[model samples]
Target: MAPKSDSAEAIVLNFVNEQNRPLNSQNVADSLQKFNLKKAGIQKALDNLADSGKISFKEYGKQKIYLARQDQFDIPNSEELNQMKEENAQVQQQLDEQKRAISEVEGEIKNLQSNLTLEQIRHKEAKLQKEVKEMEDKLVKLRKGVTLVRPEERKAIAEMYSEKLSQWRKRKRMFKDVWDAITENLPKDLKEFKEELGLEYDEDVGVSLQSFSGLLQHGKK
Candidate 1:
């Protein structure tokens, strides 16, 4: 009861444009079966549509997929196009904001995972506070000249100081003897030679052996 159609190419082109999606030769063939069109005829029609640039296609090995070309659609007016552009810009902005929010949430999650728990943090803070309080109290006592050293400790410190002073005196004498022996026959000026050799005695840098003796006497008071 239906009229016979002659143009397979026209039917295939119309079908592809109407679908507006990618369709392989077999898909077109199957869909056109109701029109009594063979696969080979559908394939040939699709190829013709592609060749004439009425539709776009991609080939995967022996198979071909056809899609309707966007350029084949009617152009929108300037006002409509501007409205579409504005809508696209708004969508893009929303997408960017969503991405930023997602990144921030991910960062926060990682930070929380890496950080110490509230109970552990409080415990560490309390320990540090106790240490700081102890140090501060000791510092205040020291500033007030409080005698923290025991009598036995003071005696031991004095003995150590005396032994160190004896060692210093012996080493200084030995150094003087060595210096006299080495420079006895040298013709260079003694001060210039000492300077050239980068040598410095105790008094050269504002330190005197006499100062240590004075300090030892002052500590007794």
Candidate 2:
């Protein structure tokens, strides 16, 4: 019987640690049953174990979800398992926060419904529905570990970057052409002078022709 009790405790610990997802009280009870452990024994063991930070027993209404404390749980060859468990904890926390917020908004919506006229109630309902949709979308993104950027928002941002890149490329091309045209119109005798100055005529004729022509035309000695 002692060995049996030890096996049950190990099973309970491993289940919560392994799943690492939230569940309500009934769900936890169901898991305990599946492990073939008596519900009362498992429940008692869980509660006591939780006090030592060995597990987390979160109560959502009558439902309880048990998660193994990352600090306490261990599995061999589980690389960065602790980090993964911590992330799961954060995700669970975020889910609870979102649920609370939705509940608050629902209460507000109910209050507004009671106070508003029929037409006003219709408007409020529409607004609330829109807000709920937005919140649901955000929740989906959170679950996926992605940030919710609306389609319109992303399109606007992409458009802005595209416009800037187009303009930048245009300016670069213009400057490249201008510089090429500059040396193109260098003085016919400039090559000899350049060679005399020991500055190799590596620029070749017609190099930077446009700017060189503009400079010569505007800056004649």
Candidate 3:
């Protein structure tokens, strides 16, 4: 059902006062469409309110822009304005601090990602422990004088082991040569550079080519 003309005028007046902004007849009509007020009725109500000084308006050519009376609102004093400014400054400072804290937390997360996770560390530890256990078992067998190789296979096995060991030494030397060339002009020391690259030598893992040297010959003797 359509609102009566007087009720429509009252609705339009309340809308203008609540919005407290300059609005044309079309703006008022569109806003009041939900109230079942016709566009013509809304325009008529706006005009009546303006004529009665119930709302203020400014004429721009053929269009009139209506606004609520500013004299009805209380203006803030100078002290109140200063207090509002201080409150705004404190809120801004809190926002900046939160941003800084978020940035720091993000940096820490990136740093943790660069290092090994707990699972990876546990996996590596398990592998090293397994290797240690194998070595200990081999030592126990050797102490019991258990024959791990046939007499005929001893020479062949020793020769094969020696060849493989020589190849390993050659590869190690080649790697060291390449590493030296790469790090010749680098600012970091060799140890730090190797650490940064996660590179490890045999000695770092408690094993060395020198320690394995003459193993077969010593056993034969």
RMSD to true structure for each model, in Å: 11.2, 27.0, 12.8
> What are the per-residue Cα lDDT tens digits for candidate 3 across 15-72?
9989999999888888888899988888898888878878898999998899998998
Q: What is the lDDT ranking, best to worst?
A: 1, 3, 2
In candidate 2 the C-alpha lDDT for residue 5 amounts to 41
Highest TM-score model number: 1
Please provide, for model 1 over 1-221, each residue's C-alpha lDDT reduced to its tens digit, 9 standing for 90 to 100.
22124588888888898999989988888888889998988888888778878889988988688999989788899999999999999999999999999999999999999999999999999999999999999999999999889889999989898888889889899999999999999999999999999999998889877778778888852
Which candidate do you rate higher for TM-score, 1 or 2? 1
Q: lDDT per residue, candidate 2, 73-131, as tens digits?
A: 46546667778888999999999999999999999999977886988879999999999
How high is each candidate's TM-score? 0.43, 0.28, 0.40
Output the better candidate (2/3) by TM-score. 3
Deviating ranges (above 4 Å) for candidate 3: 1-19, 25-45, 48-54, 109-117, 124-221
| CA deviation > 4 Å runs, candidate 1 | 1-80, 95-117, 125-148, 180-209
Our tally of clashes for model 1 stands at 0
Model 1 lDDT-worst window of ten: 1-10
Cα lDDT of all candidates, in order?
0.88, 0.69, 0.87
